[model samples]
Target: MHYALAPRTFLFSHYFATGLRIATGIIGLTFLAYFIADLPTAVAVAMGALCTSLMDMPSPLRHKFNEMLAGVLLCSVVALLVSLSSQVEWLLFTVIVLVSFLASMMVVYGRKAMPLQFAALFVMMLSSEAPSTPLQALRHAALFFAGGAGYMAYAMVVVWRLQRRLKQQVLAEALYELANYTNMKAGCYDIEAGLPAQMEKLVRGQSVLAERQQASRDLILRGRPTPDEEILVQVHYAMFDLYELVLATHTDYELLRQHFAKGTILPLLGDLIGKAARDIEAVAYAMTRNQPSRSNVDYGPELAALDAVLRDVPVGEGEDYDAQAALRATANKIRDVIAMIGRLHAATQASHGALPLVPHTDMTPFLTQQRYSLGILVSNLRWSSPVFRFALRVAMAILAGLVLSRWLPYTSHGYWTALTIAVILKPSFSLTKQRRADRLIGTLIGCMITAVILHFVHTPAILIGFLFVATAAAPAFLSIKYRYTAVAASVQALLLIGLTVPHGGSGVSERLLDTLLGTLIATFFSYVLPSWEYHNLPRLVDAVLDANRKYIDAAADLLLKRTGDDVQYRVSRKRFMDSLATLSAALGRMLDEPADKRRAPDELNRFTVQNYLLVAHMAALRLLMQRYAENLPAREVETALEAMFAEVRASLGAAHEAVPAQAAGQSTWIAAWPGWAPLQRRLRLLQRDAAQVAQSRTAIGAALGRD
Candidate 1:
């Protein structure tokens, strides 16, 4: 019963809800137009609504409005141009090439421009399906704008109404991912699990967590929160602090496994951490439903049992001392995690006592900044630019597809071929290959489903219902999973054509064939001027190094009491995380490429893991200082921290430079005080991780031919 509820929580997620809302607006507007006016008007309005909906991603209310507005205007203009040129074959072909290149080039502006780019291309394909006179073309473009504007207005109202709820949903999503990350971290405590595989999964999980945290930042920190939204703001802050604590839990898991191989302590620790993950997941579930957390799992017994077992373990010298200290440190961090979870639940229940003060500094720097300037696009118009190469690749594929469609028999709906090309071909070969597979599989399944429905069910009402479901599911599943999106999109397109056109269902076979053709063309062109991930390794590695350096500098300042957790530190940390995620994602793509194209796979993997460990160690060091400041030698600790920071800096320096074998010998200062054993151990771990990072960097540089 407990496991059953978990699936249900995800099934009714915010993504699905947003999909339903969009479906409601689009179908509602289309049907009303069809009933009150005519089918043509309804079709125009639906096209406009659908194109504009592509831009309706999760963002701030103001940014959402502006983005949707841009979509409406750009799509409308593209429709008008396509309509006007459809009468002349050569002119239409020329327009297709120019439009494809320009639209694909919009990627220079980053992720935010992707939907707008697709919207323009989508409208062009739709408008080209029917030729129009200059005056009718004007009318069609106007209706398209009207429909987009209407949907935009409708969407803004819905967002405004559910603004707070949206914030909660995004925050809950981050928490849920954090919970998953914690569960994965628990696997490290299992003696049977392979540490290398576990670390790989953890790195991938970090990439996902970074993305979720950014989304939370964009939504929760966009503008000043009102009095009612203060609790959410506080929860948002607490969630990140909790994430740092989780990172700080990274210690010598292998060492612990070796020491506790025959005992029950390892399993006990894993069980405790796993339960904490579930507790977090429960809170996230409550947040999604806007209900107070009703957590039933009591950690008291588990904590007491773990404490009793740890009390029985002998605290001897050397390895025994290190193992015991690592275990105790992990247990203490788990306690901190549990306490943080309580605070999170309290915030949700509106208990505001002792909430952390929200940062008053400008939060804009923490949020990702996208510059929408023509200079960026123009600057990318070079052979070396990935965007330029991608644009050319897309345009060429479309042109080849067009020529093949003209030559092929029974190709009445050739525009589908072009549409498939536009959708499938991407800048990277990995994405193009994935999309090609999804498109073919999804189209095959959707066509079969639609055929079965059309053959058996003759009720117009049932067909319309299917149409609504498909329309809503397409956009909803787009971000969740592309294969699902492709299936729903295929069904929606076929149904709309069948209902509005003379013989839409009859083209199911043609749809499959065209998808195959598009896939083939896209696959062929993917190899043309492809921007391999290996080519970017130098820059990505440098970015990881630079971000880690800045992050360590900020962390050191905070540890030494020179700064608070100000915006600067937060920004540095966020940037570091972002860079790590970028590098990790790039490496993933590189691995997916052909084996010959992959560079430094082992070295890059090690570099990423070591960098991750370096950050975690620094976080642990900070927590150690906070916990033992009163008992330790303050001056000696500060001096040692400075030395440790220098060691890390030297290790992370340019790959060509020589790094010291040992920058700060721990025995010089750490041996003077046994009371600071925990801090001393953490410092030694930091130095070890830094040295490993340097080694990985040198290996990566050698593989890339940079050294």
Candidate 2:
């Protein structure tokens, strides 16, 4: 928790673990070949191993295996194709461009088939510098394939062993969020605190729950369902249940403080919830250590106190006392939540009961859906696809750089321009921009370090040592920060070029100039066909609204406890979650854009906050319905609430709010319901809130729609 460590905390943990694993795999395969064979063979195999290792991201072992295999095949094919066509300049150029396009399009499949494969294609492009016969190309490609295969085998085993640890880590993260939510809940009783601030924290809690839910879903979906994995299934299922139970979490500071400001039981809820949170923290520690949980958690006293208070509390008189009724409902809800926590405590015990050191894998596709079909590949060619546009942009830049590098009379530094274009231009404008900056900074730092070493340390052995260290460190930093990766990689490249070619610091100056040229080329090409998030926001917002609308309808029906509705409810839930994720991604991209281009940033942020609040409110309603069969605002008031939400939903995709005059009698109907009528006022407030968001939406559309 020290201030200094907070900035670099992300550099450790899995990044460290996986970095060490892949670095060892890459360097080990490399040296093994080096000791037994010639330098070219050793370099080819090492390059193959390093490339494959880079693709080994966090995922199910099955996907890791496929990723490694794809790397091997793609590398071999690219090498063979380039070598075969090297005799014809035009043929080689066309082949590389087409292959690059296809390789980049692979990402349309899913997260599993992305940047790794793209890197593989470019590594092959770099390999074209080697002049070779077809037979030599095949031999080199085979060695590369063997290197990739060896590393793949090692990675599969390592991941298979480490997956249990990964799941435990996920469990700890859930508990961590549980602590945050509980602490937030405990502090939400301040009547004078800002409502917006309190709501933000509350929404954050739901967001945490959403993440836990996704983790559980991934766990269950990772492999085949069978009796052998029953314990793991139970653990994942418990997470889903825990997320649902936690969803009933909400508190209005003003209402609660007014009710308990002078009462003796003012700290009752906090006392109970705080104790439960500590118990979860203990379980989290056990999970972190991969140890069995302590058998007796004993939140019994807190639960007992809560039960006693709930038993003794009286309902107040008069229709003016609906607030009191709402307060009682909130108290009862807390009691139910305490019981749920006890269940989660028990589930934690059962999960730890059979914690296996090594887990099993089975017949799961590399991705949920097949992404390699001919149709999918062809479909990605449209301008609507960002990946396609990016691939085209990079290909165009590469070809132009090559032609201009020759005509500029600086053929020696020409490859640098293309190298920069390949490495820096990513799928999004903001990403490419960030990478460009990071690449320049990292390269400059790395070039300076290399210059110092080359000036003083001319011994071959020491230089090789530095090169080896840099090579090993590159993949490690790639996962943590691209800037660090770039630094290490640039240093390695400069060291190799200096030692092999015997240049007197010429490599350093050339790299700097080449980098500068590359940056200029990349920055210009980025504006060619930018995929700005501002233009994409409406679709993302609409998707979230549509998905949540379906979720609300299905959830409402489920609260009615109808049978045969479970299947539809689940489908709706997944869509709602997926849409939310997409919206978050778009927002992230929008925030990352140049400030001048980011119109209405404050409004966009508020829109996100409002959506999060909506999610928290809906979750609370669902939990209350499931636990107590209680209609939150009564069945009659729900009609008006749903109607209001409908207007809000329609406002998301359009530039104007839905008309209010059609609902002439909504206020009158709401007035008839004295028990939960106040919820109607919240609904009306939400409707009015939509108007502000709509205005911002119009302004953004105007800016982005300009040609």
Q: Give the top-scoring candidate (TM-score).
A: 1
Return the top candidate by lDDT: 1
Give candidate 2 misplaced runs (Cα > 4 Å): 1-12, 87-91, 170-216, 224-235, 245-286, 293-346, 351-370, 383-385, 403-416, 449-473, 476-480, 492-509, 564-571, 594-606, 626-707
lDDT of each: 0.84, 0.64
C-alpha lDDT of candidate 2 relative to the true structure? 0.64
Backbone collision tally, model 2: 0
TM-score of each: 0.96, 0.76
Per-residue alpha-carbon lDDT of model 1 for 173-237, expressed as tens digits? Answer: 88889999999998998988999889988998999989988989888988788776777888888
State the displacement of the C-alpha of residue 157, model 2, in Å, after optimal TM-score superposition. Answer: 3.0
Per-residue lDDT over 1-707 for candidate 2, one digit per residue giving the tens place of the 0 to 100 score: 21112334333334455666776777678678879997778878876777787777666565567767878777777777877776677887787677766676776776667656556565656666656777887787788788878888888888887776656655555565666676666666544466566665565455555665555445545666444444555555555555555545553345556666655354766665666666666656565565545525565675677567656667665532544555565666666666666665565566434543224433132124434677876888898887788778877777766666666644456556677877777778877888899899999999999999999998988997888778766765674478888898899889878776766568897788788778888888888777777767768766766776676567556645554445556567666766666666666667787776675555555655555545445656555434543434455555765576566656544545443433443665534434344455445544554555566555545545663
Residue-level error in angstroms, candidate 1, position 377: 0.3
